[model samples]
Target: MPQPNDHRLFAVILGTNEIASAIALQLVRAGYCVVLSHDPDPPVIRRKMAFHDALFTDTAQLEDIVAERVDDGVQVYQALRRPPQVMVTWLGLLDLLPVRHIDLLIDARLQKRRVTPDLRRLARLTIGLGPGFSSDFNCDVAVETRPGKIGFVTDARWTDAADGVASSLGDVGAERFVYSQFAGRWHTPIEIGTRVYRDLVLGHLSGVPLLAPRDGILRGIVRDGSEVPAGVKLLEVDPRGRDAQWTGTDQRGRAIANAATAAVRLHAARRSTHRNPA
Candidate 1:
């Protein structure tokens, strides 16, 4: 983990969604400390959202959130209110917020295309698709394009691995709002959140491992552990539905029940080996 005083970078997720929370977790697991702030909107469920070290419901809690991380082992105070070198924009707030020190900006929603000009004008590194694709055009870092979603990095900043998606695929059947928002809407918030945390923000491959914890067929590795960084892909299961197929195993052809546990042990042992050399 990085020391709190090391010019620590952060991913300030603008919206109170899975994208924000996932990105924060990914960054923290990868050794970068994170501060997640969200003001609970009325009619919105207020479940405690855990990102990295600190979590809060109000902006006033921001300093305290960051402060707790400092005590635990994060050095983000070095930049004050300015976002660090790396930033993730899950929901729109880029224009409203200060960017004088933000080195890279990432737009996860893929809905706001107009923000790019302002982002570029600011000279902050950005990456995203154009207006024709999604709203996330103003990102300093973009990611893979998944028809309705765009993912990539600009100026070396990483993107969240999970793509933004609509819930209840086929439920909305071609409404203008659905089409404009790129809704086939198959993914649940938890699914997207898991992916963002494991892949993009963590700099891991898109094929990170996933355990079915039940009988299922194997899908390809979304992220192989060795090929990419810590927070890249693990693996993805087929979508749930009547037509969805199970591979009987996980991405690695391993039994799903033990995969998660094995992965943890393997990772811990690997780190232990590094720490205590024979």
Candidate 2:
């Protein structure tokens, strides 16, 4: 059972992909009380995280996991009643399951065909469940949204127009839905992984000083340690060298250099976990 001050973070990492597992592991390392609930919990998955209340066998097993927590004297009534604070669904999950929350929905599976009826249905489902709830909420077949951020991870593989589609989600009544496009030439997934993990860590520890991933040439020192605020520019990433420049900022455009480095450190922690498994 966690204290009132301890964050009661619930997450569901669906699928068996390395990327999905990596994201889940990163969330666990970031101090989130995550539950990797999947229909099929593989041996590799169990071995990777050892055994944790954080990992559940499947969605149906969620009640069992919660009950176990209760037996252990953990307070999980609100968690059982409310949707998870965080959910990292794989691209495959989007095709079948209607994701539950919109406050921070992310689509990492943009490799599939776009503009299809299926895609539109998925989009509509996401929009409806996201921060802006649709009147069609009576349907039990799909999940619903709460509040916060919804995003799609993009790289060169994605068309420029995709950004417009993702960005337009904000208009559907979400407080904000962003297309987190990366401008890097190599290791796109690795970088996106780092960025998302960093932001997740920050969001979990403190509610202030949000980190918004952006595109540009980055130049800055990699600092180690916490205590960085949302407004300090820890690094510089000028798009056109010094001649033309662009700076990374929070969703609010606050310079986050110091905080940015703190974000980087979070990724490092993820790496450390991979290197030294429990």
Candidate 3:
């Protein structure tokens, strides 16, 4: 547990997806007072492996790391004092900064858009994950998440950019995911890791049917009651069978998370050099 007045470096992570959750977990272990922000109803696909459920469940855990949802800055401080529990909040990025100064800020949303420079001064060290970010352009540092698995920290230039196509397994590309066709509230009674068949109605969007594209294990789905727009991701199927583990951390997520931790250390090293150079 961390105390409000303690000297721990504070970190604000701007997403609750699995990748963001991984970064929070690693930073917390690295002794950062970490906070996560999320939408009212985040359309996250991987619930089993993400802290996104904490926003609804009040508490969610991944690989022994527990995340507890807090409503406001007051509750956030309270949650921090509880040892080993990470704080998750509905407070947006703008509202959070005024609550406390942040040492680092990470955008793990993977939105794949050219980010505005508005967030550059938000923290002492700001990091953007994935292809849409560039060092000195949008964030202070950009971490590479190209071709889906690799993660590297970049400086002085943009990391790998997207080519409008996602890397996939031999045949998994394009066929494994389901995207929304129309705009409406997403509803689903199904849980992640559930077994299903091809063409099964897994859920609905504003009363319109959401069918399973192909038979396989359900790897991810948008949260029930999420108001989504057209072109939004609805769900994903693993097609890898029921025995495949769909929970806990993913290999790619861990890589990206490790890189985020490295970025923090990199910034610290540079600061040390400037203040006490040989």
Per-residue lDDT of model 2, residues 1-278, tens digit only: 44332234333333322223333334444444333332222111112212222233312112112211121112332343433322222234433233232111222122222332222242221211112122243111111111122222112122222222322222321112121122211111122112222232222113223342333332221122223332222232222323422221122111111222233354457768999999
Q: Number of clashing residue pairs in every model?
A: 52, 12, 1
Give the RMSD in angstroms, all C-alphas superposed, for model 3.
Answer: 2.3
lDDT of each: 0.30, 0.26, 0.80
Ranking by lDDT: 3, 1, 2
Which is better, 2 or 3, measured by TM-score? Answer: 3
lDDT of 1 by residue, 153-214 (tens): 12333333333342232242111011111111121213211222212222222332233322
Candidate 3 residue-wise lDDT, 48-73, digit = tens:
88888888899999997888888888
Best-performing candidate as measured by TM-score: 3
Question: What's the CA RMSD for each of the models?
Answer: 16.3, 19.4, 2.3
TM-score of each: 0.34, 0.24, 0.91
Worst 10 residues of 1 by lDDT: 176-185
lDDT of 2: 0.26
Report the poorest 10 consecutive residues by lDDT, candidate 3. 76-85
* TM-score attained by model 1: 0.34
Q: How much lDDT does candidate 1 score?
A: 0.30
